[model samples]
Target: MWPRMDGIRVLELGTPGELRTELTELTLSGAKTATAGLPALDYDAEREAVEHVGERLVLVDDSGMRAGEVEVTRVELVPFGEVGWEFARAEGEGYTSVGHWRESHRRYWEGQGCEVGDDTTIVCLWFRLV
Candidate 1:
């Protein structure tokens, strides 16, 4: 079962199109799946996929808690490939792809200045809360 909110609630706003676009870019640059460890590819087919998946993505904590959720507030295709660039650099320099992805994710979050508690897990879910 998922843990209670425990006075902690985060709202992530984004658009389904935007989320799908990000996913598409990430896949093209090697994100290759849902944050849940799915092997998702085919950027060209993402629009259809997004429509099929709807707008919400849920993130569960290690303790099986639904730590938080992110709603797709906007959808846009940008040229931000820094994560992919860093991943390629790390891999080219002999770093493990997993490590590269982990570090990249860390940096991505750090860049956003997001923080979590020691016992807390962060899950990003995208959906319309209205």
Candidate 2:
């Protein structure tokens, strides 16, 4: 299970390293308004529920320090291949296209031992810094 600060769920992006730092910085700067995850690997395996609209969460850094707070605005379950450019751009990771996003995400998930294919279910979450 993920950690909570002050009774709110924590949003820790990626692993504890450079990637996490970069992503957290983007989030804090309001550049990142969305994120994606594998429901099976991230939620079911971890026994956590998918975030709901209007839910408030604590954004945390690599060291588990609270960077800020965010409120969920939207959530959708989309197939990996069906994820679109709008969502990709909302990630604020400089993805040139949906293909680029898919490739990068595929590699990331596969590196973490999660099998990712075109049909893999992806949880697309949109949030705003609060």
lDDT of 2 at 59: 91
Runs in model 2 with CA error above 4 Å?
none
- Tens digits of lDDT, candidate 1, 52-112: 2344444333333453443443332222232243323322223366446545544544554
Residue 53 of candidate 1: its Cα lDDT?
32
Give the Cα RMSD of candidate 1: 15.5
* lDDT for model 1: 0.34
Top of the candidates by TM-score? 2
Span of ten consecutive residues with least summed lDDT in model 2:
1-10
